[model samples]
Target chain A: MKYATMRIISGAGERTLATITEVRSIAALFLHALHGCFRPSRALSASFFAQISRQILYTGVEAMGLVGIIAFFCGVTIVLQSMTTMPQFGVTEYFGNILVVAVVREMGPFFTSLVVIGRSGAALAAHIGTMRVNKEIDALEVMGIDPVHFVVVPALAGMTLSMICLNCYFDMIAIVGGLVIANVTVQVPFGIFLGKVLDALSWIDIVLSSSKGLVFGAVIAVVSCWYGMAVNNIRAVPQAAIRAVVGSMTVTIILNIVATVGFYAR
Target chain B: MPVKLEIDGIFWSAGVFPLLRGISLTVERGEIMVIGGRSGCGKSILLEICAGLKRPERGRIVWDDIDIATMSRNELLTARQRIGYVFQQYALIANYSIFENIALPLRSRGDLAEKEIDVRVHTVMEEVALFNVEKHFPESLSNGQLRAAALARALVTDPEMLFLDEPVSGLDPQTASGIRAVLHARQRRRERTIVTICHDLYLWASRPHRVAVLEGGKLVEPEENHAFRQMVEARR
Candidate 1:
């Protein structure tokens, strides 16, 4: 009985140790990639520029349609649901506040991250993982090149830039969709709805939403890169992608939780 | 300027198997050293260790008296910049064009101007007898062409010590001869130190200055290619 108990305890300890090691490695890679951005020689390399442009196009611009459809439906449904429910509490004027908090401050960045992770994060992991398996990373190291600088920084920068832009686009489309729904059903005046949205949004709200976008973007990039480059063989490539997607999702939700507690606690 | 590489008391293992045991050798400046043995004899691992890409469990790789095992990351990188390693698989980035591939090492060093990169790459390309495929992708090039491109990239950096692992293994005889000719010309012209891992005896058209065989995890010094074969058989 003691031996079996000890075995189980050691197994749990081993898993916990693995998780900690993985997280530390990811954080270290993230810092190294960030440092690469400040090194003028590496930052100014043409490869960096090309990779960033490609990543933005692939991750951000290509994700617009899915984000648009989801945002539109989400906005209309939330507003309609609020109109039906909030009248009982006589809090109809708080519709704008609810929308601002739920959509702009939270859903915009969070949903965009989900979509980006599904679409681009997997690809990034698979691509880098394939490179690792092919010994291309080894080749770079042998040639005196830092793979994180050459490979990871551009992905990190591009995803962050794209997330910020996509969040804004998501918010704009969701508002337009909500306004259309309002005009069609309860005949809320376009000017009144617009005024309410504007009134509900403080600079702090905008800053918080944008912060979510930036942090979530960096999280996805770093997580994907860390998992991708960790792959050692062809069989491990798909596993890396799955691990990256899960890791990115975890980081995104964790950041969201922290932001929520931080803002609401005060 | 040529470089000296000394592999001293090298010992390495994989899992439960010992791959290298007390292997040691010295490649003098401007000397061409060729290492050979059977498959899985740790020839490639030794090459990687010598290049500081892999650290031995128990040994010191003294590249010009600086123990790479103890060198800082930046120092190791600086040391690697002066040594070029040609992978057996050619290992070119499939995403980059041939021109870009050849220009990679110089570009990564971040010291050469674009014009200088272009000139150096083109010169090496000519020397390797590869032409007019600068914009072509690696997949489009023939195997021999890809090997030539890999060699060109290695040489474009003007590394003092060149390490080629099975560089001419998959090439036709004529192409292999051409590759050997370029290596010979470069060795004499630049006085570069070279270490090659080869499987084919015919690939050594221009005999290396020193030939050694790796068997039973030790460097077996052979007087000639014929003797190298005897050493391999003796170990097996």
Candidate 2:
């Protein structure tokens, strides 16, 4: 019994130590990426900017069609649910307020982030993991190139910029979808629905939603890249990609909840 | 400036299996040292440790009397800039074209303009006898072409020290001889130190200043015992 108790304690200690090491490593990686951003390295030549542009092209521009389709369907569903049920309770006049709060303040940033986490986050992790297995990262180190500066910084900057822009794009598409669905389903005029949405929307709501996108982007990039860098062999690439997706989604949801509570709890 | 490498009392292990046990060796400036051993006998691991690519569990690796273990990350990178390395597997970036792969070191240094980089990369490619494949990526290249590209990248910087792992493996006899000639000419033109790991002994018989055998996790000089003669005869 005593020996078993000792083994249990030892296992717990090892797990705690591993967790601490993981957190410290992630924090160090984040700081290095930030430093590369502010002061910049000599490697930040035209090629560096080209890398950032390429990342933006992959994570932002290429993902537009998917984000647009998802946003439109979500908008239509939300508006249909609200318009059909809200009038029976005599709260139809507050339709504008409900739509703005639900779509702009909450759903816009959240759903867009989920899409990015699924697509870009998994891809980033898999790419880096494959590089590590092939010893390409070591090759870069041998050439006196900082992988964090050359790889992670561009990814971080591009993902953040993409998230902010995609959030805005998602908001516009969803509202348009809502307007069309409202007019077609309930015979409500498009102008009145749009006017209500515009009236209920505030600059604060836009700022807060954009802020959530920014944070979510940084979190996804850091976590995915961290998992990618941790891979040591070929077998770990798919595992790292899966872990990156799950980790990014979990963190994004928790942060979304925190942002909502922090902003409105007062 | 030429640098002398000194490795002392190195101990390394993988998962409780000791691969190198208190191994030590040194190579002077401008010397060619070839380490030979059977496959999976930790020859590559020792070369990697000497090149500062992997840290040993206990030892000091010094370049020109400066201990590499004490150097900061940037300082270590600065030191590594004076060194060139070629991996056994090529390890070329999949996304980069051949020209970009060869020019990466120069681009990272950021001292020379694009014109100088282009000139230097072309020169090295020519020296390696690789032509007209500059725009192609690694995936499209043959094994010989890939090896040539990797060697060209290593030599583009004109480094003072070169650490090559099986640089001539998997090539025909003529291609292998050509690679050896290129390395010999480069070393003769400039006082460059080279440490190579190869299992093929006859390939490097006439070139290296010294040949050492790694067996039983210890490095032994060629003249130390009968095992050296046995290794050479085995290769023959």
> Per-residue lDDT tens digits of candidate 1, residues A219-245?
999999999999988999999999999
- Residue B201 in model 2: lDDT: 65
lDDT, candidate 2, equals 0.89
CA RMSD for every model?
A: 2.6, 1.7
Docking class of 1: medium
Q: In model 2, how large is the Cα lDDT of residue A135?
A: 79
lDDT of 2 by residue, B139-175 (tens): 9999999999999999999999999999999998888
Assess every candidate by TM-score: 0.95, 0.96
TM-score of chain A, cand. 1: 0.97
Clashing residue pair totals per candidate (backbone < 3 A): 0, 0
Candidate 2 collision pairs: none
| Model 2 residue B198 lDDT score | 80
CA lDDT of every candidate: 0.88, 0.89
lDDT of 2 at B217: 87
Model 2 residue A68 CA deviation (Å) reads: 1.2
Give the TM-score (vs. native) of candidate 1: 0.95
